[model samples]
Target chain A: MLFSRPMIPIDILVYGIGLAGVAAQAAAGVLEAGRKPFDLFGVVIVALAAALGGGSLRDLLLDRTVFWIADQSYLITALTAGLVTFALVRFVRLPGKLFLLPDAVGLALFTVSGTQAALALGAPWLVASLMGVVTGVFGGIVRDVLCNEVPLVFSGELYATASWAGALLLIAMKASGATPGTSALAAGVLVLVIRLGAMRFGWRLPVFSARL
Target chain B: MLFSRPMIPIDILVYGIGLAGVAAQAAAGVLEAGRKPFDLFGVVIVALAAALGGGSLRDLLLDRTVFWIADQSYLITALTAGLVTFALVRFVRLPGKLFLLPDAVGLALFTVSGTQAALALGAPWLVASLMGVVTGVFGGIVRDVLCNEVPLVFSGELYATASWAGALLLIAMKASGATPGTSALAAGVLVLVIRLGAMRFGWRLPVFSARL
Candidate 1:
C-alpha cells in the first residue's frame, strides 16, 4: 500500500461532460457492433473503439498520454456500457433507430472538448476547429468501418458540418474574451442543436456527380 | 534566408530505409484509393494518410513532433510516390498481386523503425513492441477502411504476427546491447521473411468460430 499510486481527481464539470460523452459514444458503439452481430469480445472492442477511439486519436495527435491509459475510469465506463447494451439487446425490444440520439450527444460534447483542449495547447484557431471536428466524427467513423459499413461521415447528413459550425463559434467566443465556462457551454449547445436539427430535417451535403 | 531553420542531417541508413517505407506505403495507399476510383484529391488524401498516419500516431503517443511535420522531405517523398503511382495506374497493366510486395517491405521497415523510436523515448519493451506492430499495420488498416474493405490485418495471413515477431526480436537484441544498426537490420529482415513466407504459404490465424 505504501507504493500505491493515488487516483488523480479531475475537475467535476469536465468529468461530468466527459462521462456523458463516453456513455453516449459507448452506447452508439454497441449499436454498430450489433449491426454486425459480432461476438462478445468483438462487441467490447467496437464499444471501446466508439467511446474512446476519437479522443485517443486526438490525444495521440496532440502528443499527450491517451486518456484511458491515464485514467482507468473511462475504460471501465465503456466496458460497462457495452456489457449493459449487450444484455439489454437480449432482453428488451429496443428500436434500431434509438442509437442516433446518443450518437449526436456524444458528437456535440466531443467537439467542444477537443476544441478546448487544442486551444489550451496553443493550436491555431483553424487547426483547433479542424481537430474538434475530427474528434467529434472520428470515433463513429472507426465504429462504422469496423462493422464493415462505409463511414457515415463520408455521406451522412451534416455530421462534420455541425461540428465545424460549433467549433467556429467557440473560436469566435474565445477571441471575444468570453469565459471558458461560457464558451464551452454555448458551443456544446450549438453543436447539439445543429446536429439534432440536421437529423430531424434530413439535411445533407450535395454529393459531387462528376467523375474525376 | 536569414530566418531559415537549419536542416538537420539524419543518419543515411535510417533515412534510406524510412524513405523506402514511406514511398512503398504511399504507393499501396494509391492502389487502395483506386479501388474506390476516388477523385484526385481523395487519392492524395488516402495516400498521405497511409504513408504518414502510422508514424504520426506513434510520434504523437511518444510525445514527439510528427516526423513529416518536422521534416518536409518525408512529406515530399510520400506525395511524389502517390502522384507517380496515380500516373502509373493509367499506363501500366499492374496485377493486383503486385501490391503485396511493397506492402510487406513497408511493414518490415516500419516495425523496426517504430520499435527504435519507442525505445529511444524510454518506453518499456512490451509497449515498444506493441507500438512497432501498431506502426507497421495502422496505415494499411486506415487505407482499407477508407476504401470500404475489411482490413487485411483483421483476417490476413500473419500480418500482425510478422510485425510482432520483428518488434520482439528488436527489443531482445537491444536489451542485450547489440548495435542499433545490427538490431534494426536483423529485425527488418526477420519481418520481411516471415511476411513473405506467410503470403507464399497461405498462412492464416484460426478464425474464432464459437458463438457467444
Candidate 2:
C-alpha cells in the first residue's frame, strides 16, 4: 500500500509528515539516552527504537510489511537525525525541555498516521484508536525501558490521553463522512494542542498505588 | 502448519511443549513482577507480555499469523498459569531461584520452535537464528521493561548467548539434512544445558562501559 503510487502531492505531504515525526522522535531518543553513559551504538539503538518501534509493532499486528524495510528513507532519516543530535549535544549543552515542542508534533503526527493506517486495513474502531495511541507513545516507552526507567507515558502529563483523544476524534470524524485528509488534519491539531497544553499546565491523570 | 493434522502424536508433543513453555514463562513473569506493587491487572499484563511477547514478535517479523491468535489454547494456558502463579505466591513464599529450571526449559523450547518457524517460512540463516534468540528472550525483556527494570537477559549470565548458540546449531543441523524433529530436539537440549550450566557455574560475558 505504501508504494503503490509515485510521489503525488498528497503522498508527498503525508510522507513528509511521517519523516518529520521520525526525525523528531529520533532526536528525542538521543537526548533521553544521553543522560545515561551509553556509547554511540547504544544511543543509536535507542534512537531507532524510539523512532520506529511503535510503528513496527503496529505493522506487525496488522500483518503489513514493516515500513522501514519497505522504504529505506525512514531508517536513514532516523539514523541521520540521531547522529546529528548526538554530535550537537556534545558541543552545545541542550536543555532537556528543548525537545518538548517537536516531540508534541511527532506525537500528533504519529497518532493520526497510525490510526489512519489501521482504519485503512479495516481494523475495528477501538483497535484502530489504540493503535494510534501506541504509535504516539510506544517509542518513548521503549526509549525509557532501554534507559532503565519507568515509561514516561505511564505517568507523565496527558501524553497518551491526548493521543487517544485525538485518535477517537479521527475515527468519529471519518465515521461522520469527513474526508480522510481533513479528518487527519483536525485530529493532528487536537493532539498537538492537548499535548502542548498539558506540558505547559502540568495536566495529569490521577496517580494511584494499590497494595493488593 | 500447526493444525493441518490435528492431534497426531508428534503434533500433540509439539503443541504440548509450546503450552508448557508459555506456562513456564507466564509463571516466571508473575514471580518477577511480584517484587513490584502492581495490582492484579498489572501483574496479568506483565505475565502475558513475558509469555507471549517473544513469539508474537517473531511471527510479526516473519509475516505469519500470530500463533496465539491462530490458536486460543496458548492464550488460555498463559492466563491460567499467570493467575495460578499469582495465587500460589500470595500463599507460599517462593524462592527467587525456584523458577530457573522451568525458565531454562522455556528458553530452550522457545528458541527451537522460533528458529524452526522462521526456517519454515524461508527466512535466511541469519534471520532465522536471530528469530530464535528473539523468541527466547524478547518476552523476558518486555516483562522487565513493564516492571521498570533493565532486562535481565542483557547482563545476567549467558542467557541470550545460549539461545543464539542453540539457534545456530539448529540451522546447521537442518542444513545438514537432519529431520526437523531430531534437529529441534538437539537444539533444545543444547540450549537447556548451556543455560543451566551458566546458572550453575555463573558463566558471564564481559560487561563494558564506554564514555564516548
Candidate 3:
C-alpha cells in the first residue's frame, strides 16, 4: 500500500491535528517541569523535548529530514505552547487528570503518523509498529527522565500497547485496500479510545518485583 | 581539511580506541542499570543507549547512516559488556570512582570522532564542536534519564566544555594542515585529561536555583 499519497485533501485536518498534538505534549511537558524546580530555560527545553523528541527520533531513524527542521510551524507551535505554559504555570491549577485526554489524542495521532511514515519507507510491519509506539511515547519518556522521574509509559498499562494496536490496525486496513485517510483516522480513533479508557479506569501493568 | 582521509595508518589505533570507548560506556550503563531494578532486557537496552546513542544522534542529525546499522561489532561489544556486567554484578564490587576513568576515555574518543564526522559532512567549526560535545555527553544523558536521574552532564562542570575544547583544537590543527591522526590524538588526550581532572576535583557548574 502506498502510504505517502493522501487519498483526499486532508492537509488542513492533518495539520490541525498535528498542532493540537504538539500543544498537548507541550502542555504536559510544562506541567511536568512545573512539578520540579525547573528554571525557564529548563522548562522550555523539556517542553520541546516532550513535544518533539518522538517525532525527531522517528525521522532520524527513518533517515528523513526532521519535520521541525523542514517546517518552522512545528517549532513555533511547540515553543509557543512551552513559553505560554511556563508563564502561566504559577497561576494555573489544573487537575492532574486533565492531561489524560490531550495526551491520549496526541499519542493516537502520532502513532498513526509514525506508522504511515514507516510504511512509506518500506519498513517491516513489526518495525513500523515499534516506530509508532516510539513516536507516541519517546517524548514523554524523555520529559520524565529529564525531570528525574521514572517514565510513566514503562509502567502505564496499555500505553505503548495502544499505539501498537493502532499501528497494526492501520496496516491491516491498508492491506485490505482502504484509503490512507480512512486507515489513519480509524487507527487514531482506536488508540484514543483505548488510551482514554485506560486512563479513566486507572489501568496499570503488573510490576515485576526483582528478587536478587 | 578533508576529515575522512587518513594521514597515517592509524586504523588499528582508532578501532581499538572506539571499541574501548564502547565497552566503557556499556559497562557504565550496566553498572547504572544494576543500581536500579532493571531486567536483563532493560540492561541491554540501556547499555546500547549509552554506548551508541551519541554517535547515532550525530549521524542522524548529519544525515549519515547510523554506525551500528553499517557495522555489527559495536552492537556485539555493547551487548556483551552489558550481559557480562549483569552476570557478574553480584560477584563484583566496584567503587563508584572506577567508572570515571572509562567515562573520560569514552568522552574524549567520541568527541574527536563526532567532530571529524561533522567536519567531513561540511559542518561549520562551531557546529562540529557542538556535535563533538553532543556525541560525548549524549550517551550518558540517555543512560541517566532512563535510570531516572538528572543527567550528570547538565550540572557536571567541564564535561561538555572539555569536548568543545578538544573539538576546537582538532579543527584548529586540521586547518593548519596537521595530520588527521595527530590532531585527533592530541585533541582526545586534551579532553581526557580535562575530564579526568574535573572528576577528581569535584568540578561542577553553578546551579540555577529558580526563585519561587
Candidate 4:
C-alpha cells in the first residue's frame, strides 16, 4: 500500500471493537450480579445495566433508541452470560489479577465504538472523541455506583485518557482514510499501549480538582 | 374551590423542591467527603451533582442543556449552599434529621418539574408523568451512588410514585387547558401531600423483588 493510503480497514476494526465491547459487558455483568440470584428481571437488569449503561446514556444524550435495544443479540448475550456466571461461579475461580483484564478490554473497545458512533452522527471531532471516552468509561462508573465504589475513573489508572487517545487515533486514521481494520487496530493498540504504559510507569493525571 | 380538579400547583412545589434539593446536596456532599475541608470546587461539585443530577438526567433524556447549566442562578445557589454547609458543619451540631426535611421538599418539587418538562415536550402522558418521577428522585439516586449507599429509589418508599402521581395530575390539567401556573400548583401540592403523607406515616411501596 502506498503511504498516501492506509492499511487495515476501519470497518473491520470497528466490527472487532463492537464484538469485544459486547463480550466485555457480558463478562462484567456476570461478575457483578452473578454472585446472587434474583428473578429473571433482576438478573437481566444487572447484566444490561453493566453492559449498556454507558451507551444508553450516550444515546439518550443523542436522543436515539439504545443501540442494544435495536440489536436484540446484545441483550440476549448479556443475559446468557449473567446466567452462566451465576451458575458457574462455584466451578470457576480466576486469580484477582486476571479478573479485570476482560473489563479493560471492553473499555478500550467501547472507546472506539463511541468515537465511531459520534463521528457517524456528525458531531465535531472533539465532542465525538470525548463522547467516546465517556462511553468507554461510564458503564463502569454506573456499575461502581450501583456497587457502591468511587468510580475507578476518579482514582487511578490512566483509564479515561487512554480511551480518549485511542478514540483520537481512530479519528485521525479516519481522516487519513486508513482501511477500517487498520484504523481500528491503530485505535486499539493506542489504548492498550497507553494504559499498559501508564500502569508500568506509574503515570497519573494530576488530580486537578478535589471534587471527585 | 371544588374537588373536581386536583389541588396544589406544581410550579410552586418545584420552586420549593429546587431550593430544598440545593440544601440536601450540600449537606450530603460534606457527609460523603468525610467532613473534609472541601474547597470551592469540592462543595460546588457535590452541591451541583446532588441538586442537578436528577433534573439534568431528565432533561438530557428529553434532549435539553440542564436547567442549571442554562441558568446560572441554580448553579450559584447550589454552590453557595454547599459552601454554607461546609462552613457551618464545622461549628454547629446540626442533626442529620434536618437534611431529611429539605430532601423531602426537593424531591416533591422536582418530581413535578420533571413531569411538567416531559409533558411540555409533548411526550405521551404516561411517559411525561414518569419522567417527572424520575426527575424528582434521580438526584437522590445519584447522591446515594456518590455516597456509596444503595439507591433510595429501589428501597421501600413511595418516593418516585408520589412524584409520578403529581406529574400525571399536571399533565391531566395541561391536557384539559389549565394554565401552566395553575397546573403547576396543583401538581406540586399533590406531590407534597403524598410524600409528606408517606413520610409522616412510614409509608412504603411494594418491593417486587428482594435483595439476596
Q: Pick the candidate with the highest DockQ.
A: 2
Positional deviation of residue B139's Cα in model 3 after best superposition, in angstroms:
2.5
- At residue A155, candidate 2 shows an lDDT of 60
| Cα-based lDDT at residue B177, candidate 4 | 95
Give me the overall lDDT of model 3. Answer: 0.81
lDDT by residue (tens digit), candidate 1, B1-212 = 42244554657876787788889889889988897869989999899889988888777766667778887888999999999999999999777777678678889988988898778766657667867977987787777777877665666577888898999999999889999889988999999999999999987654423222
Predicted candidate 3 versus true structure: per-residue lDDT over A5-93, tens digit per residue: 33334488777888888988998899988888779999999999999999998888877677787767788999999898777767877
TM-score of chain A of 1: 0.90
Could you report the DockQ of all the candidates, in the order they appear?
0.10, 0.12, 0.11, 0.09
Please report how far candidate 3 places residue A58 from its true position, in Å. 0.8
The best candidate by lDDT is 2
Q: Could you give candidate 2's per-residue lDDT for residues A1-212 as a string of tens digits?
A: 66654333447766887888899899999998988999999999999999999998788777767778777889999999999999999899888887788778888988998898878766657667867987887788789888988666656578888998999999999999999889999999999999999998988764433222
Of 1 and 2, the candidate ranking higher by lDDT: 2
TM-score of chain B of each: 0.91, 0.93, 0.90, 0.80
Which structure is stronger by DockQ: 2 or 3?
Answer: 2
- Candidate 3, which segments miss by more than 4 Å at Cα? A1-53, A65-133, A143-148, A155-212, B1-13, B33-48, B60-63, B69-80, B83-87, B90-98, B145-150, B154-158, B193-212
Model 4 spans with C-alpha error above 4 angstroms: A1-10, A32-48, A76-92, A99-102, A122-130, A142-156, A164-190, A201-212, B1-52, B56-113, B121-133, B150-212
Scored against the native two-chain complex, candidate 1 gets a DockQ of 0.10
- For each candidate, give its TM-score against the true structure: 0.61, 0.61, 0.60, 0.57
State the displacement of the C-alpha of residue B110, model 3, in Å, after optimal TM-score superposition: 0.9
Candidate with more favorable, higher DockQ: 3 or 4: 3
Indicate the docking level reached by candidate 3.
Answer: incorrect
TM-score of chain A of each: 0.90, 0.93, 0.91, 0.77
i-RMSD values for every candidate model = 7.1, 6.6, 7.5, 11.9
